[model samples]
Target: MQRPQTVVFTDLDGTFLDHETYQPGPALEALEELLAVGVAVYFCSAKTRVEQQAIANEFRVDVGFVVENGAAIYATAGAATVFGMPYAQVREALHNAAAACGAAVRGYGDMDVAEVMEHTGLDERRAQYARQREFTESFVIESGEPYELSQAMGELGLRLQRGSRFWTAQGEHDKGMAVRHVTTQLGPNAESFGLGDFDNDLEMLTAVDTPMLVQQHDGTWRDLHVEDMVRLSGIGPVGWCSGAELVLRRHNAR
Candidate 1:
């Protein structure tokens, strides 16, 4: 039988990047190896296209990426095909939800660069890139229970994704949808591996042939069950490398 094509999907913030430094760290070498072997590595993250674009340039990679928690997918050098509600409509809905629920919600669209930097610890320039959102709005609820906020979002035909620090309001599309879409496009015989380290990655981590949960900076793992999924030891890029090497080895052996 022919060996299946190998494809890797990785989360950015706390999977491919160091949770604290935001550097690729050990995953850098692994990424180079993957690219050297012509294996496709696609970044899957809640980050904006601007942010992922810069990362793609830095890595010298052109493989398509899923951005904003799969709100959209941008093929290499192609126009973005969005699967979720547009940012303008989501923002408007959020405002209405906040007003109706009397919740003190602060979304990325509502904050200035300074505020974003303060809240996210990203430098001013990176914060500016993050603010270039197109399909999803990440916000924090300061005065309302998370359940209440989720209920409000549900009533508006939206959903809330609970991240480690914030909640994202978006349409029904998620990383799983994007992953499946891309992999199916590659071929029915392609093999997929997904790596992630947070709640936001739940759907993605479960939607792959090889799901990998990386250790967190705090030495914990996201509580999710995926049959036959691999749990890597190292955190962030360290775990990313370990998992990549393992999967690639298996692929090569086949």
Candidate 2:
């Protein structure tokens, strides 16, 4: 019997990378193992291409990546391409919606490097990279009801995603749409495995043949109702490694 070609779509911050130190840690082993067996692991993240590029270089893994919450995709062999609304349009709509809703919204583009560093705990270089938004932008509501902001955004044909630390606004497409796009390019026979740890990851998690949810940094798991979703035992990358290994073992055994 021929094994199905494996492809993994994973969240970065709190899934493949440690939520605190932002390193792959134990997940590096499973990543290498997957690569050795010709599996492609695409990072689906809210980070900009610049930030994702830096992380990819740090890990020394060459793979396709979906950035800006599925706003764009950068294949390992081709240029980056947009899959969502233009960043300029999204920015204008966001501001207009926030104003109409009477919410004080502050996004990454509205902040300097110092302010970004203060808010995200990222160093200056990373903060600079994070601010280079090409598709999606993250903001916070400083002085208004979140529901009002959400209602306003929806009225303007935009959507808001609640991430671990900030609220992101972008086009209709999310990580699941990006994953589906990548899967088609991988050929009809390729099977997908997705791993994530937050509500924002729900789309990607539910789009895969095997969906895995790992424990968060604080030891709580994101509650999601997906068919056959696997909940791993460890937190962050530890659970990622375990879940990946388990999936691979079961997949190969069949």
The RMSD of every model to the true structure, in order and in angstroms, is 2.0, 2.0
> Per-residue lDDT tens digits of candidate 2, residues 59-136?
898878899888888988877667778788888999999899888999988899999999999999999999988888
Clashing pairs in 2: none
Poorly placed runs, candidate 1 (over 4 Å)? 1-3, 77-79
TM-scores of all models?
A: 0.92, 0.92
Determine the backbone clash count of candidate 2: 0
Model 1 superposed RMSD (Cα): 2.0
Superposition error at 242 for model 1 (Å): 1.7
Give all candidates' CA lDDT scores.
0.86, 0.87
Candidate 2, run of 10 with poorest lDDT:
245-254
